[model samples]
Target: MPWIEVPDFQPRRPAQAKAQETRAWYSIKNAASEDEAEILLYDEIGGWLGVTADEFVAELGAITAPKIKVRISSPGGSVFDGIAIANALRSHPAQTTVQIDSLAASIASVIAMAGDRVVAAPNATLMVHDASGMCLGDAAEMQKMAEVLDLISNNIADVYAAKAGGTRDEWRAVMRNETWYLPEDALKAGLVDEVMSAKQAPAEDEPAQMRARFDPAAYGYRGPAEPERPKPGPPPARPEPAAEAPAPALVISVADALTETEVAALRELAQAHLDTAPLDPPATTDLDELADEQPDDWAASLAHLTTPAPWGQALEHLTQTPASSATDA
Candidate 1:
């Protein structure tokens, strides 16, 4: 006998982007497709998200305004650059707000937390992960780089811990273990705040999408699914092609090449020659012989051997000086 009103149930509008600590909101304008090989050439992850580290820091410092906005949608960048950006954010003069209009992942996640405020799109995503670097050098240098990486990881953990309102250990556990999070999940995990911008429906993910880096031909991750319980099978037998006398192509695996008795012997002989034979340095012995044929003085025929390097001064050192006035007593 009474009129009933229906309750409004529409979603609330997303908050307008507040000017962040840096005053200026910067975003990366160019990023290749996910299928392309990412070159950390500019040092800002796939150049996704928004501003590069250089631009971000320089702009952040120049902001006279109270708040700055960092518009991000990156797939992430080099861990080194990410840390540099993060360190900048951590020590910035003003508050920094990192806004993920799309995704901030891997090293980008580190850069995002360099903010006093972190927000994301309604359908955005974030992933936390350990730092990785390609190092090549002497064994000692490689080992030193490894230690440096471990230190970087800890420093990154400290930033995430501070921004997320979480402990360093808690952050490191998730990061070191490669935790990926949906927007809501990231918010729940304290990696970010509320999703700020609205978005269309999240893209349907393919199985191959996660393997963005692996070469499909070289590292086949997907094929016909293997049997749930793999059955024991004989090891793959490499094909033994019929030999031709003086084959046109010498293509062969090193293992197979060495397995040949004649090839092995030849390889050993070559190695022995390289190891045991004394290689003559560029010497004047031959020049001396040629000089003797020039019909000149025997002094001209003298062997032109290089003198040994001077070592007397470098091999030992001794120094003495008068005692100072105070010490002489």
Candidate 2:
């Protein structure tokens, strides 16, 4: 009964330092601010598990790779944190390539700009808007906060201007409109260097990741009409063997989408603008200009100056063509 013998005592080896170098870390987290609430929230499932500026720098430094590829699919985060991360990437010795595999909105777009080459998936989206944050305290404090926000916006515009080869004022105007860009639009705007590889056919089986969804109205934004959610169905049966050789596949292009050559031309046009002229700050602030420029009501005032985006024109053309074609017939 007392024959139980214990194995020779062995101490566990101390964790080896830099034993395994990380090539990539999925930056699928939010850019949360450093605060008690944010920290606690990040700790919990409800909060976005974001990589802070310090953490991003540390990871980049720790990795010994000469080239790094960062994959981003974030809904933007803290502006300062994003900026810090961008600077870290920019200063790193390694050649960095950022792949926007999915969405890269708000400050995430700024971070994307830091890459030596930024590539976006055809379906990826990039959004830019004026810097905004909540404020508290008295009127004086509010005024101070507004001024700080304006400065921050200017700083962001400067970053975009440097990367996208546009004047700071032009970028700021785009920001004020809260613009969203597809891959082609991004390429044209110099937001992305190139579009990602071609799309693949739908797959029957693939691992699915949980996607977060929210009301657009909550963010003061509106998006395209949502497609109906598909119900889970039984997998399709295997097709019967064919007697004859399959006919050559017929490819049909969507009328609304851009062609590869067109996208390349847009990229060329964007590259040509690399020698952008610097802009002087206007004599008056943007707010002052807005007042002076828009004496009419909001709808009528913006009409004279607002030029419809190419994508909008494409959509309208696509939508009307079928009806007009039918009428002609």
Candidate 3:
């Protein structure tokens, strides 16, 4: 597929208020003399990475850069987006540089590894762990999840190993431990090539407040040339975030959230996965929608379950909401 340039989504900034997730932004200062460009990830709302389908690869495309540098300061959002952008970077032909100035946890780590050159500021951090996503269904349902998880584990391993130049088993061991590595330690683990001191970066104090945060427009980059946004159509009804119980020793599925087709999907996904093989879990859609469509007639909804997993890895990289009881209500 051709790369689609999209508009950036970021919280508007006033000089007075501090930027929430933006770590910082820097440019080569000269377009001709400077062959370098940058990608920034700092979305305020946890969802969407503050970017949408149209906005993907916004920064990477904006600067017309041959040597791309991505500076990250994000808490992390949907793993789907993280991997999407990371995959985009992998496809990049230029010399890519990924700089971690702050925390790169969860999916952010994938983005960090997209770089051919990965560097971290002294205080920067990196985290690795098992891939996770919300799930629905019963015992048979959960059995399927194991397979999908196995695949996600491999994908994650491939990323770290490619960047770290380490064996996959050793890398998997690092993820199994699920530890966050600070700059010095991460370098020791071969996750990064160098940890540059503040002096190594351009001369100036990055205000804790500024964090060099700015909207995509402020950076002199507009991913794709788009006209003013049209007014939104009537707001679609929001889906309920079915209240989840505290992490149970075992994750139990709520009947209201799972129906026949969903149950079957979970079963198929699980069956596909062997002890070592990883399968991608099906997507979490409105089970209510699935329930209404009988499997025989509905291709998109009910039948969606039994089909090959909707996606290889879950787009929503979070845990399934455990069933919440009446007391919470």
lDDT (10s digit) by residue, model 2, range 109-222: 888889888889778888999887776678887887778777888899998899889788898899999999999999999889989668655444322311123345778777
* lDDT digits (tens) for residues 1-329 of candidate 3: 11112125455555333232322321223222256665666542135334332245554555566777777777666666678778878887778788888888877887888888889987898899877655567776576676677677788888888877877788778888888999999998888888998686544654442454545677788688788988889988999999888785865665445566655666676665443232544343676664464343345333435654543333222243434323334
* Tens digit per residue, CA lDDT, model 1, 1-329: 10011124323332232223112324322223322211111223423232234555564455454445666777775565567677876786655677776778877887777777777777777887776666667888778777877777787788778766777777778878888888888888787876664544545764355455455757655667866987799999999998878847767565553336545555655575466533654335586664555435334323212322222222222122345433544
| Candidate 2 lDDT for residue 16 | 41
Candidate order by TM-score, decreasing, is 3, 2, 1
- lDDT for every model? 0.58, 0.64, 0.65
Off by over 4 Å in 2: 1-51, 199-329
Best by the TM-score measure: 3
RMSD of 1: 47.0
Clashes of 2: 0
**Candidate 1 or 3, higher TM-score?**
3
TM-score of model 3 (CA atoms)? 0.48
